[model samples]
Target: MPEPIELHHQGVERSIGCYLLDTDDGPALFDCGPSTTIAALKVGLAAEGLRLVDIRHLLLSHIHLDHAGAAGALVREHPALQVHVSEIGAPHLVDPSRLERSARRLYGDSFDTLWGELTPVPEANVHVVGDVVVGLACFPTPGHATHHVSYLDDDGTLYAGDAAGVRIQPGRYVMPPTPPPDFDLEAWQRTIDEMDRRAPERLALIHFGVADDPQRHLADLRLELFDWAEFVQGGASEEEFIAYGRAELADAGEDVAVYDVAMPLWQSYRGLARWAETR
Candidate 1:
């Protein structure tokens, strides 16, 4: 097992990351960056003496554009590539028209520019697995998205997509990426507890790098989720939520670049607010 290489996109250090893992079967990539970042991914792979077509397995945390947007294009290019994703998210990846429409409601005109065109992945290339991948274990870690999954490598490293929220570093705050429709607080809490039970020694966060302190990271994220949920339940408007989020990020010394992407504070407020109303 080779050490995971982080592919920083668009010259941004910590905005979005695509991780490459070398396995016995072949070179595998976890979470292809959004379609817009495909060129950067190509560059990253070339530096490693590999190419996009060289990737045999693509492990997606979910079908969210930021995480798996490039998957379709990659699959189309790499004939032998197999996509390992949650069963719930598989259908959407096969035909992303519905997902694209939903995202348009949120992102408006910038949708295509930010995420690029999402192509349909062939069904034959899809591999729906449960809590495991290539000898590693995968946990159905929902809450961030109904279709989200987290992979735990044999070395006790948890590839926590959005399951652990956005923690750029140990000193930074763990901000929840709660989006509309499927941000289940109950399930997310349960997922957090499950992660705690597993007690991974290190966490490989998709937002950026890895963290050796899993316990502290999970504890902080759990608390942050509760705090944000309660705050949103108080009926704060989107503007207020953004203001609050900006302040919090500044206080914690996190890069405000996170706000520039799809998982902004407004989406978090909306997701938590919806969860509060229904649950």
Candidate 2:
């Protein structure tokens, strides 16, 4: 029997976890996490009676170190593996210079320790998902990153790459992942409203699992994102907003597994903060 795709939980940073899918096409890891989480991913897959070598496709939401710092590493490890990413995000994976430089600004010396060496995915190997759907459409999500994209599957489950916002609490509280260089509240809401029209049954977030209650998720996300934006716009500086955002985000009461999937959601926090400053 060809097994259905399964979402494997690779807990990252004591707070977040990565969601990988196991399909008949072969295992597909959505995001790699900071290189630190690969071991956890392997462990998660093993528990499910699988292994990393089973991964033939690495579908990246974006090229942020947290989402795909190990693209090169993965391809290196699995020579036959290919990567699927947004057209806008394809070059970074193929070149990785801007990606590395940006990460350096945020993580300095710890970048290497945290994200391992990242080389480019060969042009021939890069799959640039523009707006079409290979069973999933690339929905533009600007609040998170200029090149951020949310993948919507046929069943209406949107793989919201920080697009629908961050939901770390069980009661449905959400805050914008408006990391800098691309935090456009106007665009963010517009995108959400568009997704809302589609009425997805669930939202698969990069930092965690799925959100089936789209309305509650959208409502909570809309309010909180703007709230954070207003808070940051008030008087806090970039450094201050990041420090404050991290502290505030901790109060979210979801399963540690929710956060366990991705650590230092701070990477998003830092970027969102930058967006706040500009807006």
Candidate 3:
């Protein structure tokens, strides 16, 4: 299993991370943290004796800023890099104006500080992933986002972006990051079934670290996802939802602040609220 290179997002440990793994082609990154953490990313890569140019491919699970915000910046530094992303996500990478707008609307004043620059990855360098990508089984795993996908390595490590939910391990709690405009409970349930059917040995999570116990981790995620969705659908206000989530984390003996950094409880509430309204 590959270890996550902690980006130390906002100087918080294990809040955001990316993975560097070897592929049939060359060194590849599972997900690159936002451009704000590019400096830390370089430091982490240097510790592994690799420069930015040494990476040949970048496998993106989604186009969310935290997961792939550095795609264009990284490619600008290393033009030879090939970026493999879901078909729906390819165009967004080549032209991120709309993505930037939506994110700005959500993040408001803190946008620039949180994500830095949203550069455009040249279309020539972007490849829509198929059933296979750099020797891994690529498959759709939406519901977190319509464009969400996951890659299964030969070693049975699933590069599960947010589809696997957020679990800042060594912590026992799992929380779903159901961000707005695309948080479908039904779709996410099917995604969970698909993942369970494949039965990966481990999950490479971008929010924090790898989980050796996929079964237990996924079960917890499913439970929390449904619980949160139902709570929101039951008309829980933002404050009530936050309090509910904090209480759950506390009961589980997990660090509420760390989990919030990994996946904000408020954002999750908003996403669920939107989902409820739509339903």
lDDT of 3 by residue, 10-122 (tens): 88998999999999999999999999999999999999999999999999999999999999999998999999999999999999999999999998998999999999999
Quote each prediction's TM-score: 0.94, 0.81, 0.99
Model 1, position 130, has a per-residue lDDT of 75
lDDT tens per residue, model 1, 1-279: 223344454455676776788555788888888888888888888988998778889988999888999888888888789999998999998888999999999889978777888998999999997756876788799989988998887778888888988876544577889989799888999999999999888887777668788898888889888888888788878888889889998998877885445257777888888888996
Candidate 2 C-alpha lDDT tens digits along 1-279: 111122232323323445566434666766666565566667766876777778777777777776777788767777787788887899888898887887788778977766677777788778877675454666676656667777766666677767776665343556566555666778878877887887888887654457778888888788876776676667666567656655665665544344424434455555555665565
Model 2 accuracy (lDDT, Cα): 0.66
The residue ranges of model 2 lying beyond 4 angstroms of the native Cα positions read 1-14, 22-26, 169-171, 237-279
Model 3, C-alpha of 264: deviation from truth (Å):
0.9
State each model's CA lDDT, in order: 0.82, 0.66, 0.92
Overall local distance difference test of candidate 1 = 0.82
* Per-residue lDDT value at 125 in model 3: 100
Q: Please tell me which predicted candidate would have the highest lDDT against the true structure.
A: 3
Order of all candidates by TM-score, from best down to worst?
Answer: 3, 1, 2
On TM-score, the stronger of 2 and 3 is 3
lDDT minimum window of 10 residues, candidate 3 = 166-175
